[model samples]
Target: MFNKIVLENGLRIVTENIPYVKSVSIGIWIEIGSRFENQSNNGISHFIEHMLFKGTENRTAKQIAESIDSVGGQLNAFTSKEFTCFYAKVLDEHLPLAVDVLADMIFNSKFNEEDIIKEKNVVFEEINMYEDSPEDLVHDLICQTMFDGHPLAYPILGSSSILEKINKKNVLDYYKQYYTPNNTVISIAGNFDTDKTIELIYKYFSNWIPVKKEKDEQCPPMFYRRIMGKTKNTEQLHLCLGMKGVPQGTNEMYHLMVLNNIFGGSMSSRLFQKIREERGLAYSIYSYPSSYKDTGMFTIYVGLNPNYVSTVLQLITEEIDKIKNGGMTSDEIYKSKEQLKGNYILGLESTSSRMSSMGKSELLHGKIYRPKEILEMIDSVQREDVENIAKEVLDFNRLNISFVGDINNNQIESNFKKIIG
Candidate 1:
């Protein structure tokens, strides 16, 4: 069972005690993300994530890495448009130490000027690296186009022009505005004493004051989403399509997950069985759903020869029409439910996954739902529910598509015609 504790200072701690496991995964989830920024401060959240490792007031970046390495533990962090997390997986013997290190990086980083300059270039190079990978590029396009002009449209790895202008003061200012006790959740999983663990967190974080900041400036609703990005060549064509979907905490959210699983999400899904196994159109094809606090999207991605790009899009639309008109089978419904259960159960093996689960659920829903509860929720979804979601969501007229590859602009226009036709 997992236990939760809300601190006096407003930091929430979530923990699970698995006695059989000898390791613990701890994560600090800050609610703020790239969406909290304007164009001037874009990418600062990610840049600050990098800076956290460069050193704390008491530890150098190398010492931090070496300390974790010396103990055979792993320390890492990531930033997304919706949240940023710093996590550590350490042996149970070092749980207290891990908590100290993580809390320090989050609450007391010095943001050194020298390290800031070097990490800036590193982020720029990271952006270059993404330009070389079509899969990442096209998905970025999907997100940017799907939520055009909203903060969601901006890439997590902001452009070099903005990263170049990013500075230590700006990063620290962003951190101050958002990384507060009220805005953070601490998730810890695996063998540990609940009381002692909470004590460790309270001991470290108690002195930190809660911060209140101005609300993020709102943007208008997005429509007719499209990403037209230009870059150097790649072999295969990468294409992504998305339609606006439901937000979290709704009945429609459950149905959308089931709908995506049947259409193109699974290995047995219609898109996979038809496009890859049957037609030999691509090596990989799948769909997934992503939900933020207020909004969500259902997206499909495929890679194929630049020549057959049009055919792939047509097949995808055909499958969408099939699901929208006819609905899913008992067999697809059962298989997808089983797949969902299997993935959730398998995730329990890792402390990191559990930590993330605990944090995000609490952050988004103000509650923690166990794995068993989630599987049951998935299992309870019916074929009728899946079909209803498809009818409401899969509108060819409202679809958004993004392409990133070495192809003629005419092909892009042809894609639009085929979808609309």
Candidate 2:
């Protein structure tokens, strides 16, 4: 179970007490990321995430890392399309240490001018590294093609040209605008006294004044039929087919998950079994749904030899059509529901997963459901629900196709036109 308390400053502290565990996981989730950024300062959120660990008022870069390492604790952070999280996992006895260290990084980071200059090179190399990996780069291209002219299409890593001009002042200014107590959630889970943990967090974060700033209101990204092909010297063709999907917290999302699982989410899924196991058309192929605050995307990725691209796309298209037209069997629906429930339960067994779940639920939805509630929701999904969602979200005509490999543009255009038309 989880409990939450909203502080006077508008910060929320949510915790789950797991008596059986000896470790606790804590995270600070900020409800802003690359999507909130405009074109000029696109990657600053990710950049600031890195700068937070460089040095604080009292701890040097080395000391901050050593403080956690010396105690056998894990400390890390990640930036996503709509949010950023700085988290740490440590022994329950060291909960205070974990909280203090994270607080320091969040509140006292220097964002030094010299460090900004050096980290820009590091981020640039990181961008180049992704460009060299076609499989990874293709996913970004898919989003670019789907959301042609929106901020959502901007790469989370920003662009080399933009980063080159960003200075310390720019990063600090952006950080101040978004990183407020009201805009953040502190989540902790594991064996600990709830009152004590809350007190510790309050001690570290209470002094900060909450700010009132207007959040950027973004219109949902419109989807269109687009085919983007980038010719590169690669061994296999990396292709992604995607369409616009439901937003977070929508009722249809549950049906969409079940639909995706039966279609391509697991090894027993239609795409994996038919494409990889049965016909040996591709070594990697699967489908996933990405839901954000206002909108989402449903995408399928495949990496196969250039000779197999045509066959693979055809098979994938056939599988989707089959699911949409005929719907999945009762057995498939039962198994998928069971698999989803079991995985959701097993995932919460870890302190880290529980902490993350609590944080995201509160931040994204403004409410968190108990495991029983979630399982019930999953069990309530019927075959018709899945079929209805599939029909609404899956359309061959209104889809985007992105490919990265040694494939000519004319070749892609011809093949896609034949199938989509």
Candidate 3:
């Protein structure tokens, strides 16, 4: 069971006690990310995330690290399309430290000028590192192409041009706009007293004055969401294709996940078997769904020899069509459900993953749908549910394709339209 508490000031705290675990993981989830920015402030959300760890009103950067380190705890954070998280794992004895430091970073960052100038260079180097990695490059190109004119197209690691000009003022302004208890969730799971944890969290978090922005001013929809294609310089041909899918929390999302597993998400999935092992096309191939607050994406990716790229793409399209038109066998449906259940149980074993699950659920849905409830929901899915989702999202006409790698005689780009069709 999961328990929820709302403070007088409107901060939602969700707690779960896993007695079998020796450690507790706590996550502070803020419902703001790249999708909240516009072209001028493209990567400000991510930049703000980096700046928070520099220091807060009560603790210096080194002190913050040492506090967690002294407890043998781990701390890290990430910025995503629809949310940002600062998370930590520590012995149950140190839950108060985890909550205090994570809350301080969220509500009390100083946004010091010296830190600002230094961190911009750090961010710039991070962008350069991303540029050097082919995997990151391909996904970046896909988002840019798919959401062409929207803020979602902005790279999480701001473009070098944007990062060079980012300043303390920009970081502070973004921070003030989005980081607040009203816009945040605190989730903790593992071996901790739920009542004591809530008391400590409320002690630190109750006075968070909500950051308010004028409702009259509206930013445009953050994602244009279309198909994007590109050619890049690399050894193997890289292919990415997808279309918009359901928003988070939709019942269809459960079906989509199960379908994706049977189609491309699992090691025994069609794409992995056909493209990787049976045909020797490439080393990696899979499909996944990315969820945002109000919208999401269904994507397929493969890396293959240039000579085999066309066949691989054709096979991918054919398999999708097969799923939509012919649907799955009874055994496929049963196995996919089993895989889904296994994954859910296995994922909950980690403190980080469990806390993240509760944090995001509370951020989006106002409560943590208990893990047992979620498993029951997954078990309730049927063949028709999976087929309906496949037909709903597999429309090639409404999709985007991103191709990376330098093919000496590249016909993949030239033949993409015909091949996908």
Candidate 4:
């Protein structure tokens, strides 16, 4: 069961209480990330995420870490394109301490001048590390090519030029604007008394004042069907193909998941079977769907021998064409639905996973779906739905291709256009 309450200030508190489990996972989900940023302030969300742990007024950075560690608890945080979360998992009894630490970090963290400079250098190294890995870098390249001029294309780690430009004032101002109680959600799952947890949350969070900020709706992403490549001395060519997809919180979103599973989401998927198992053309191949508040991306990734890029690209196009033209059978539809249902159910068994699901749902949709509700949604997908979505989204003419490897520009331009045409 899910329990939810919204504070007067608009902070949302959602919880799931599992009686059998002795552990509890708590997450503070903020409704701000890279998507809310522009070129000048890119990566500020992620940078502020790191800065939160540096220290709070009442707790030194080391003390903050030790407080959680001493209780045999775990604390961590992550920043995504749309949101940032700071979470802690501990024994049920430590829920109060966890709440206190999280609230303090959000409300009282001092973005120190000296610490800002140090973390800036650290983020610089993180950017360099990504540049060193071509496989990882290609995804960013694909995003840049696919989204083009949109803010969605901006790198989450940002660039060295922008990082150097960001300072304490920028961090503080951004945090003040977006870290209001109204822009936050606190989610907990696993063992807890619902009423007691609610009281505890109010105790820690009630005093934080809300800010008046205008709701900013993102402009629908304008996708460019671009074929871009970078030459790098890598062992194998890393290829990524992407197309615009349905946004989050839509009926088509579920159908797209079912479609991706049959196409390349798993080892039994068409791309994996055709490209890896049967032909042995690539060691790694898969497809995934990324849905945001207002836009989405369906992407297929493959790492293969540079010599076989043309052949692999041809086969990929063929499979995509086949699906668009009714390659998905009733059997494939049934199995993929079953697979999606099983995965969704199995994933919910963990407290952390439940916390994350509820947090995202509440922040994004203002509502949460229970296990049975989601399973029903998965079951409702049919063969025609998959085919229709594929036909609408899988046009070769609208595809974006990104490649990184030791390959020449002429080889890429000629071969990609030939296949795409």
Q: For residues 347-380, what per-residue lDDT tens digits would candidate 3 score against the true structure?
A: 9899888889899988977767777788988989
- 213 Cα displacement, candidate 1 (Å): 2.4
* Model 3 poorest ten-residue lDDT run: 215-224
Residue 26: error of model 3 in Å? Answer: 0.9
lDDT of 3 at 198: 80
**CA RMSD (A), model 2:** 1.0
User: TM-score of every model?
Assistant: 0.96, 0.98, 0.93, 0.98
- At residue 226, what lDDT does model 2 achieve? 91
- Find the candidate with the highest lDDT and give its number: 4
Model 4, 321-400: lDDT tens per residue? 88988777999999999999889888977899999999999999999988988988899987888888999788766789
Residue-level lDDT of model 2, residues 283-359, one tens digit each, is 89999999988899999999999888778878888888888897579999999999999999899889999999889
Error of 2 at 157 (Å): 1.0
Regions more than 4 Å wrong, model 4: none
lDDT-best of 1 and 2: 2
Q: State residue 87's C-alpha deviation in candidate 4, in Å.
A: 0.6
On TM-score, the candidate that comes out on top is 2
Global CA lDDT computed for model 1: 0.84
